[model samples]
Target: MEFLAIILAAGKGSRLKSNLSKPLHEVAGYPLITWVSKAAHAAGASTQICVISPDEQQLYRELSHTMKTVIQVAPKGTGDAVRCCLPHIEKLPKDCPILILYADTPLIQADTLRDLANRIEAGTDICLVGFTADDPTG
Candidate 1:
């Protein structure tokens, strides 16, 4: 099924206490955003848009070859980050499925995303993927 993957990656990573953006941080061999994009692509997303901050020039340059990007302008919230991609989203088909993902979550699997898309195709209005963590404390 054809779907749009909107990756929200505008966080300043203040919590990580690092100069590097959260998405640019490497989990294994690839950047976090790279892993997310790979899963999105494998799940059959026809279009992918990455939501980034204004100062993320390096992120923009890196993702330029594969996907489109929109600047969130301010670190308002997740809603505002997705809102920045409205122009690009509007151009897609009205009924097209949209999958919202976080770039920092590199552990998500492509099969999981495909299953979510399958649920949507099976007439589910909206699908949210989540897991119960044994230890919620960070």
Candidate 2:
């Protein structure tokens, strides 16, 4: 089945209390953005689009050619970030599966994503992934 991945990387990483953007922050040895993108690619997404703020666009320059980029003009919310990628979404086939992922969640595994898509292809109405947080407190 055809698949498209939309990685939300526009967040400012304010919660991390760091100057670096959330997507630019490193997880393990790679940037948070790279981990998510590589996972999406590994999961067999035909195309990947990473929505990021204009200022943080350069953080993903290496993937500019292979991965599509959408710039969020305003720092709205996740809903708005999704809207920023509407054009790219529209270009896809009407029935293509769209996988929405967050860049900051770098711990996600490729196998997990692949299984989600497989479930969808097998006739699930919609698939959602959840992780058990060690600490729920903010």
Report the CA-based lDDT of candidate 1 relative to the real structure: 0.89
lDDT of 1 at 19: 76
Report residue 32 deviation for candidate 1 (angstroms).
Answer: 0.7
- TM-score to native of every candidate shown: 0.92, 0.87
| Residue 53 lDDT in candidate 1 | 90
lDDT of 2 by residue, 93-127 (tens): 77677888998788888888888878877778789
Where is model 2 more than 4 Å wrong at Cα?
60-62
Query: What are the lDDT scores of the predictions, listed in order?
Result: 0.89, 0.82
lDDT by residue for model 1 (1-138), tens: 888999998888887888777898998899999999999999999999999999999899888788999999989999898888889888988788889999988989999888888887788999988888789784
Cα TM-score of candidate 2: 0.87
Residue 5 lDDT (model 2) = 87
